[model samples]
Target: MTHPHRTSDPGVRARFLLAATAWTVLVAAVLVAVPLTFAGRLPDPVASHWGPSGRPDRSMPAAALTLFALVWLVVAGTGLVGLARARGEIRRATRAWFAAGLGWIGGFLIGIQAVTIAANLDRDGWSRAASLSWQVAVVVVGAFVLGALGRLAGRLGPDDAPPERERPGPLIDLDPGRRPVWVSTATAPWAVGLGVVASAAALSFAAAALWGLAPAGWSTALPLALAGVVGLAVSSVSVRIAPEGLTMAFGPLRWPSRTVRLDRIERAWVEWRSPVQVGGWGIRGLPGRATIMIRGGECLVVRYTSGGQLAVSVDDAETGAALLNALAARKTA
Candidate 1:
């Protein structure tokens, strides 16, 4: 369904594209110009990785530095495309911040390379001045870049009123004498897909390690991370609506939960939406809209007195929507 009030500003898209393109060009220039300016003055294999103590711990051949620069360029390009496609406020702020991040990566790479090359001009290792001290400079520059981009993007708050239309039909009716409490659970197939991918990655790493090719610390850290992913994927979302308001919990642990008061709701109805409307599933909120979507089907949508919208995708959503409308109507009366 088409929203009654949706902002489709072409200027916003233009700004996002321009910001990303400019940052990509700047990074490419730094990567190409820096090396050629100081040709033959840098070491063959330069310090590339720094340890917790701010000392060089790993080195990469100077010729291979082009690979690192190319990687960042590709990342910036991909990020720009992804961010440009985002909806609502997420597109506005995240795009600028992401561009700034690309700039920071470029600055750090160029700074470290310059320091390394200068230090290695006279010897194989870093000189007293060319040590990890360059990190301080890069960090400061990165902070400035982030600040500048954030200011450029301005306020990142979600919109106060999302595009929506009132249902022409009457709401569902619930028995006035019955208990007010209603409970529902929802699941997403995408979560299962993510779990499968995580498990496969962990298994692949372990198989490689058996052949003596995997990193040492990865054997433990990778499994732990993968386990966390699987746990989150399989977890079910629980939702309840009562006289007081609506509440949501995740899995048995119910670690993160939320409640909203009935008095704050101005309207309630059933809706069907795609992931694009609420920014692609899973407890996502943007300005005027907050969505708890497990699957993209029937949902209960509520418009708040504060002009914000909240939605939950679940089974028997018609009953939930009806109950919400009846309860909210009673409170308003």
Candidate 2:
């Protein structure tokens, strides 16, 4: 049998693509028109960068800057649209977030371009351009406000019906008095290697700061150290399944963990998945699904009674899924 929520709908996909295309075209038009409208007033070279003191430090040709901004907006819009389309039938919340993100980026670029033009209006040269600190701040704030509005607009339409997919595997035979538990660990050696490299770099920077070789090295070292810690944390996770349900702990400390109670689980199944299928590695939150991916291959997928699903990549996913399904069945029976 197939679940209604998991079935793909063509209408939903078409609407998303159409909306995305319209937004992209509209933003592209604004970016192009604003500059050409004020071409006579703007200097040949416009101020594109400002130093810490708010003085224009870098300048680019007016035409080139406009072209660059348009290119950037198109690329970003296309990427967001492609990702959404690739996910097929997605949840309304996810679509809203994606729309808001695209709106914010497009608005931000357009606002910055407009501000730059205003700053350079009737200027003798790039050096005489007005300081844009306050104007840039206004643009950022306005972009965020527009993004929130876009999110609301995106949610106005009806939500797509859940897609259709086959149900979980056959139940396992279990003794009435017996309790079975499954445990496994998933790890990514590449992530661990990256973490080690980052840690090494952080230590080098810290030593340089201590020796007064690079006085501001601490600024760089702190962020690197934090990234290293995060990489290590996500490099491995321990998964446990028992009569109580499923529990997943990240890293050796297991401080940050997630648990799904047996009562909430409606079904369990094993599916082969890759990183690209659910965005890149790490913890991925999609439309109606959440994935904890390490080295993706066979993933144990759990569907909650509330219609949401979670998938985790680990060894012996078939056994883990079968055992979990049996436990869930027992609970319901």
Give the best candidate by TM-score: 2
**Stretches of candidate 2 exceeding 4 Å from the true structure:** 1-9, 25-87, 121-127, 162-170, 174-197, 242-245, 251-318, 328-333
Off by over 4 Å in 1: 1-9, 32-40, 50-55, 70-75, 87-106, 109-129, 153-219, 222-245, 251-323, 330-333
lDDT tens string, model 1, 1-333? 646665445465566567568867876777777666665766667666666676667777767656656876787776665555544344444444554566566666666556556555555553222456655676567657755764465333333343356672235556778767889988776676666667677777776777778766466648756775755644557778898888888744665787888888777787775454455557787757878767666788888888788888878877777778878878777
Cα lDDT tens digits for candidate 2, 280-305: 67889874688988876888888889
Please report, in order, the local distance difference test score of every candidate based on alpha carbons.
0.66, 0.80
lDDT of 2 at 323: 88
Please name the candidate that would achieve the greatest lDDT relative to the true structure. Answer: 2
lDDT of 2 at 142: 86
lDDT score, candidate 2, position 151? 87
Clashing pairs in 2: 4-162, 5-162, 5-163, 6-163, 6-164, 7-163, 7-164
Q: What's the C-alpha lDDT at position 44 in model 2? A: 83
